[model samples]
Target: MAGDSLFGIHGAALEVRAQRMGVLASNIANASTPGFKARDIDFKQALASLEGGQGGGIAAATKYRIPVQTSMDGNTVELSEEQTAFAENAIQYQSTLSFLNGRIGQITRALKGE
Candidate 1:
């Protein structure tokens, strides 16, 4: 877990974001399926649980999303909303990855006495 200390919460954050992306993608994929309720992860709660030494996976933070406008088929997966969330989560995942890469580069340089 040395990397955990080196990367801080960004590591866990990246995992949560990745999981969230999958959930959002599922929502988008199931948009047409009747009675398919969209589920999303609570990033803050997930990260906190991980940091708190809770062994539960991100599934612990997964919850059904409340649609702003419900569809007649009882499906809660809103295409526009799911797409937007997926895009935002992807951006955040990339940002976290970049930060971790930068940190690793810095550590490598320090070890090389550069």
Candidate 2:
């Protein structure tokens, strides 16, 4: 159960990060759209909900995005902010992958008795 839970948690975090990246991309893509506001996911709350027996936290985030900036023309996306957030999210995602990979390597080594 613990291993299943860890895998589930890691998968959920990965999905959330991916979706957040998509949102960030959407914001960047619609930068010229007069009324777009940038949006983001609440990772902490999403993860909590998933871990609280909610059947994977990533599902909690796939549907919608919370606006970070509201525009006069009803647009919630801001180019500069979206770009910054995207960069940061990408960095975090890479770090998460690196850590997962390291863990995998350790597991492999232990299995091989190396």
Find the candidate with the highest lDDT and give its number: 1
Deviation (Å) of 65 in candidate 2: 7.4
Off by over 4 Å in 1: none
Which stretch of 10 consecutive residues in model 2 shows the poorest summed lDDT? 56-65
Error of 1 at 100 (Å): 0.4
> Per the 3 Å backbone cut-off, how many clashing residue pairs does candidate 2 have?
10
Where does candidate 1 clash, by residue pair?
Answer: none
Per-prediction TM-score to the true structure, in the order listed = 0.92, 0.74
lDDT of candidate 2 at residue 81, scale 0 to 100: 68
Which pairs clash inside model 2? 35-74, 35-75, 36-75, 36-76, 36-77, 37-75, 37-76, 37-77, 38-76, 38-77
Model 1 C-alpha lDDT per residue in residues 7-61, reported as the tens digit of each score: 9989889989999999999999999999999999999989998877786768899
Model 1 — TM-score against the truth?
0.92
